[model samples]
Target: MTNPERDPESGKLTERYSDEDFLEAVAELEPASTREIAEAVGCSRRNADVRLRKLEEAGEIRKKKVGNSLTWFSVE
Candidate 1:
């Protein structure tokens, strides 16, 4: 399959999924966590959290509690 997004020179994901990229990843994954996305984006979990929250507010992501911590996922 073709990649949804990638850096032109390095040919790696430039950052955490854009809204569209996150949607693509979520479509391919079960509910995932902020840390997971953060690692994939090559950023700090805290930074990912910020972007994730923005996505959530835009109705691109959904957050749910799993045990003491919360995991974020793309919504239908």
Candidate 2:
């Protein structure tokens, strides 16, 4: 899969991404907390949480409750 490209002007991503992109982002940040995943994927924490839940349910990743927060890890 092609990596998302960054905007030439602002240097931020300007394209829409698929769930696969989010999965790749999560894998890049394996053992990442929700916030870290969101930051890495350029998504809001709430949006990241929703996507993470789906990924977890699909067995693409794992979410472990650590203290008061959840940490995500790549299944691979």
Candidate 3:
């Protein structure tokens, strides 16, 4: 199967899996847990944490602390 990402040439995604993977995970998933992103990205939990942290620092992702735990979400 082809990559589920958008083709730069064709300008069409091979499949919605890529976007769905992220969107579905975030849909109504407010106050998201670190584990949620890991499951969404289909990566290691530690790896997910790192990616999320980077995105957050870059302002690509937004995170808020609900008590001791942090709930992450995408800004746009």
lDDT of 2 by residue, 1-76 (tens): 3356899899998545567867887788877899998887777899889988988999988988999999888886
**Would you list the C-alpha lDDT of every candidate in the order shown?**
0.68, 0.81, 0.65
Find the number of clashing residue pairs for candidate 2: 0
> At residue 66, what lDDT does model 2 achieve?
92
- Tens-digit per-residue lDDT, 1-76, candidate 3: 1155778999887642344454455554756887876676676677667666776687766888888777887686
Task: List where candidate 2 sits over 4 angstroms from the true fold.
Answer: 1-15
Which digits, one per residue and each the tens of the lDDT, describe model 1 over residues 1-76? 1235787998987554465555555455547777777666655788777887888898887889898656877676
- Sorted by lDDT (best first), the order is 2, 1, 3
Report the lDDT of model 2 for residue 73: 86
**What are the RMSD figures for all models against the true structure?**
5.7, 6.4, 5.9
Candidate 2, lDDT over the whole model = 0.81
- Identify the leading candidate in terms of TM-score: 2
Error of 1 at 26 (Å): 3.7
TM-score per candidate: 0.63, 0.73, 0.57
Q: What is the lDDT of candidate 3?
A: 0.65
TM-score, candidate 3, is 0.57
